[model samples]
Target: QQQQQQQQQAAAGGDGGQMTEFSIALPAACAQYIVGTNMVNIPTLSKFGAALTLLRDNISGDVVFSYKGSPSAVAESRTLLMHGMNMFGVEIRRQQALLQEQLQA
Candidate 1:
Protein backbone atom coordinates (compact mmCIF):
# COMPACT_ATOMS: atom_id res chain seq x y z
CA GLN A 1 0.00 0.00 0.00
CA GLN A 2 2.82 2.47 0.82
CA GLN A 3 4.65 1.69 -2.39
CA GLN A 4 1.43 2.02 -4.35
CA GLN A 5 0.68 5.42 -2.82
CA GLN A 6 4.19 6.67 -3.63
CA GLN A 7 3.79 5.49 -7.21
CA GLN A 8 0.46 7.24 -7.49
CA GLN A 9 1.88 10.52 -6.19
CA ALA A 10 4.83 10.37 -8.57
CA ALA A 11 2.48 9.68 -11.47
CA ALA A 12 0.22 12.57 -10.51
CA GLY A 13 2.99 15.06 -9.80
CA GLY A 14 4.94 14.41 -13.01
CA ASP A 15 8.66 15.23 -13.36
CA GLY A 16 8.53 18.22 -11.01
CA GLY A 17 9.32 15.82 -8.15
CA GLN A 18 9.09 16.79 -4.48
CA MET A 19 9.27 20.12 -2.71
CA THR A 20 12.24 21.05 -0.48
CA GLU A 21 12.51 23.03 2.75
CA PHE A 22 15.25 25.46 3.76
CA SER A 23 15.74 27.32 7.04
CA ILE A 24 18.11 29.80 8.73
CA ALA A 25 18.34 31.43 12.13
CA LEU A 26 19.34 35.07 12.58
CA PRO A 27 19.52 37.55 15.42
CA ALA A 28 16.06 39.00 15.97
CA ALA A 29 17.26 42.59 15.66
CA CYS A 30 19.07 41.88 12.39
CA ALA A 31 16.02 40.15 10.94
CA GLN A 32 13.73 43.01 11.90
CA TYR A 33 16.12 45.62 10.51
CA ILE A 34 16.47 43.91 7.15
CA VAL A 35 12.73 43.28 6.87
CA GLY A 36 11.88 46.84 7.84
CA THR A 37 14.33 48.19 5.25
CA ASN A 38 12.90 45.86 2.54
CA MET A 39 16.35 44.45 1.96
CA VAL A 40 15.22 40.83 1.74
CA ASN A 41 12.64 41.24 -1.07
CA ILE A 42 10.04 38.78 0.23
CA PRO A 43 7.81 39.05 -2.84
CA THR A 44 10.58 37.83 -5.09
CA LEU A 45 10.66 34.55 -3.19
CA SER A 46 6.92 34.16 -3.78
CA LYS A 47 7.48 34.88 -7.45
CA PHE A 48 9.87 31.92 -7.51
CA GLY A 49 7.10 29.69 -6.08
CA ALA A 50 8.77 29.59 -2.67
CA ALA A 51 6.80 30.21 0.53
CA LEU A 52 8.44 32.06 3.42
CA THR A 53 7.71 31.52 7.09
CA LEU A 54 9.12 33.44 10.07
CA LEU A 55 9.33 32.39 13.70
CA ARG A 56 10.75 34.31 16.64
CA ASP A 57 12.33 32.86 19.77
CA ASN A 58 11.47 35.27 22.53
CA ILE A 59 13.89 33.96 25.12
CA SER A 60 16.84 33.72 22.79
CA GLY A 61 15.88 36.83 20.82
CA ASP A 62 16.48 35.04 17.55
CA VAL A 63 14.37 34.67 14.45
CA VAL A 64 14.09 31.66 12.18
CA PHE A 65 13.30 32.01 8.48
CA SER A 66 11.92 29.02 6.63
CA TYR A 67 11.43 28.62 2.87
CA LYS A 68 9.80 25.77 1.04
CA GLY A 69 9.73 25.01 -2.69
CA SER A 70 11.70 23.20 -5.35
CA PRO A 71 15.31 22.57 -4.24
CA SER A 72 16.65 25.05 -6.79
CA ALA A 73 14.15 27.70 -5.76
CA VAL A 74 14.96 27.36 -2.09
CA ALA A 75 18.69 27.51 -2.83
CA GLU A 76 18.20 30.67 -4.85
CA SER A 77 16.12 32.19 -2.07
CA ARG A 78 18.94 31.55 0.39
CA THR A 79 21.44 33.15 -1.92
CA LEU A 80 19.28 36.24 -2.24
CA LEU A 81 18.83 36.47 1.51
CA MET A 82 22.60 36.36 2.01
CA HIS A 83 23.09 39.05 -0.57
CA GLY A 84 20.59 41.25 1.24
CA MET A 85 22.49 40.70 4.47
CA ASN A 86 25.71 41.75 2.80
CA MET A 87 24.03 44.93 1.65
CA PHE A 88 22.75 45.50 5.16
CA GLY A 89 26.30 45.22 6.50
CA VAL A 90 27.48 47.81 4.02
CA GLU A 91 24.70 50.18 5.04
CA ILE A 92 25.61 49.77 8.68
CA ARG A 93 29.21 50.68 8.00
CA ARG A 94 28.15 53.70 6.04
CA GLN A 95 25.94 54.87 8.89
CA GLN A 96 28.73 54.44 11.40
CA ALA A 97 31.15 56.42 9.28
CA LEU A 98 28.63 59.22 8.88
CA LEU A 99 28.09 59.29 12.64
CA GLN A 100 31.80 59.50 13.29
CA GLU A 101 32.20 62.35 10.82
CA GLN A 102 29.28 64.22 12.36
CA LEU A 103 30.76 63.87 15.87
CA GLN A 104 34.12 65.19 14.62
CA ALA A 105 32.45 68.20 13.00
Candidate 2:
Protein backbone atom coordinates (compact mmCIF):
# COMPACT_ATOMS: atom_id res chain seq x y z
CA GLN A 1 0.00 0.00 0.00
CA GLN A 2 2.81 2.42 0.94
CA GLN A 3 4.75 1.53 -2.20
CA GLN A 4 1.65 2.14 -4.33
CA GLN A 5 1.10 5.54 -2.71
CA GLN A 6 4.73 6.51 -3.42
CA GLN A 7 4.31 5.49 -7.05
CA GLN A 8 1.14 7.57 -7.33
CA GLN A 9 2.92 10.65 -5.90
CA ALA A 10 5.84 10.19 -8.26
CA ALA A 11 3.51 9.91 -11.23
CA ALA A 12 1.72 13.09 -10.20
CA GLY A 13 4.93 15.11 -9.95
CA GLY A 14 6.37 13.93 -13.34
CA ASP A 15 9.20 16.05 -14.79
CA GLY A 16 10.67 19.28 -13.48
CA GLY A 17 8.30 22.24 -13.89
CA GLN A 18 8.46 25.02 -16.47
CA MET A 19 10.64 28.08 -16.21
CA THR A 20 8.62 31.16 -15.15
CA GLU A 21 10.59 33.99 -16.65
CA PHE A 22 13.07 34.38 -19.50
CA SER A 23 14.71 37.68 -20.38
CA ILE A 24 17.64 39.21 -22.23
CA ALA A 25 18.80 42.74 -21.57
CA LEU A 26 20.02 45.08 -24.29
CA PRO A 27 22.11 48.28 -24.56
CA ALA A 28 20.77 51.21 -22.62
CA ALA A 29 20.66 53.48 -25.66
CA CYS A 30 19.05 50.90 -27.92
CA ALA A 31 16.65 49.83 -25.21
CA GLN A 32 15.63 53.42 -24.63
CA TYR A 33 15.20 54.01 -28.36
CA ILE A 34 13.06 50.87 -28.72
CA VAL A 35 10.91 51.87 -25.78
CA GLY A 36 10.52 55.48 -26.84
CA THR A 37 10.41 55.67 -30.63
CA ASN A 38 9.43 52.15 -31.76
CA MET A 39 10.40 53.08 -35.32
CA VAL A 40 13.49 52.32 -37.40
CA ASN A 41 14.81 53.37 -40.80
CA ILE A 42 17.61 51.87 -42.87
CA PRO A 43 19.17 54.14 -45.48
CA THR A 44 20.47 53.14 -48.84
CA LEU A 45 24.26 53.44 -49.03
CA SER A 46 25.10 53.32 -52.73
CA LYS A 47 24.75 56.22 -55.14
CA PHE A 48 22.21 54.34 -57.21
CA GLY A 49 20.36 53.38 -54.03
CA ALA A 50 20.86 49.79 -55.18
CA ALA A 51 19.64 48.17 -51.96
CA LEU A 52 16.35 50.05 -51.84
CA THR A 53 16.04 49.72 -55.62
CA LEU A 54 16.59 46.00 -55.44
CA LEU A 55 14.04 45.67 -52.64
CA ARG A 56 11.53 47.58 -54.66
CA ASP A 57 12.55 45.70 -57.75
CA ASN A 58 11.46 42.40 -56.26
CA ILE A 59 8.33 41.30 -58.14
CA SER A 60 6.60 38.97 -55.69
CA GLY A 61 7.10 40.64 -52.32
CA ASP A 62 8.89 43.41 -50.42
CA VAL A 63 12.22 42.98 -48.66
CA VAL A 64 12.72 44.03 -45.07
CA PHE A 65 15.69 44.41 -42.78
CA SER A 66 14.90 43.61 -39.17
CA TYR A 67 17.52 45.61 -37.34
CA LYS A 68 17.92 44.85 -33.66
CA GLY A 69 21.21 46.04 -32.19
CA SER A 70 22.41 46.00 -28.62
CA PRO A 71 25.70 47.08 -27.13
CA SER A 72 28.10 44.13 -27.10
CA ALA A 73 29.18 44.62 -23.50
CA VAL A 74 25.65 44.46 -22.13
CA ALA A 75 24.80 41.41 -24.23
CA GLU A 76 27.97 39.67 -23.08
CA SER A 77 27.18 40.40 -19.45
CA ARG A 78 23.66 39.04 -19.75
CA THR A 79 24.97 35.88 -21.44
CA LEU A 80 27.47 35.37 -18.62
CA LEU A 81 24.78 35.79 -15.98
CA MET A 82 22.49 33.28 -17.72
CA HIS A 83 25.37 30.81 -17.99
CA GLY A 84 26.09 31.21 -14.26
CA MET A 85 22.43 30.56 -13.44
CA ASN A 86 22.41 27.42 -15.61
CA MET A 87 25.55 26.12 -13.87
CA PHE A 88 23.99 26.79 -10.48
CA GLY A 89 20.84 24.93 -11.51
CA VAL A 90 22.89 21.93 -12.62
CA GLU A 91 24.73 21.84 -9.31
CA ILE A 92 21.44 22.03 -7.44
CA ARG A 93 19.95 19.17 -9.46
CA ARG A 94 23.02 17.03 -8.80
CA GLN A 95 22.78 17.71 -5.08
CA GLN A 96 19.10 16.79 -5.05
CA ALA A 97 19.82 13.55 -6.90
CA LEU A 98 22.52 12.66 -4.43
CA LEU A 99 20.17 13.35 -1.53
CA GLN A 100 17.48 11.17 -3.10
CA GLU A 101 19.98 8.37 -3.63
CA GLN A 102 21.11 8.58 -0.01
CA LEU A 103 17.51 8.52 1.18
CA GLN A 104 16.71 5.48 -0.97
CA ALA A 105 19.84 3.73 0.27
* TM-score for each model: 0.59, 0.34
lDDT of 2 by residue, 13-36 (tens): 622221122244333332323222
TM-score of 2: 0.34
For candidate 1, what is the total of clashing residue pairs?
A: 0
User: What CA RMSD would you report for each candidate?
Assistant: 7.7, 24.4
Candidate 2 segments whose C-alpha is farther than 4 A from its true place: 1-70
Per-residue lDDT tens digits for candidate 1, residues 42-96, read 6644442222234222233666667777566677778877876787788789999
lDDT of each: 0.64, 0.39
Please identify model 1 stretches exceeding 4 Å from their true place: 1-15, 39-41, 44-60
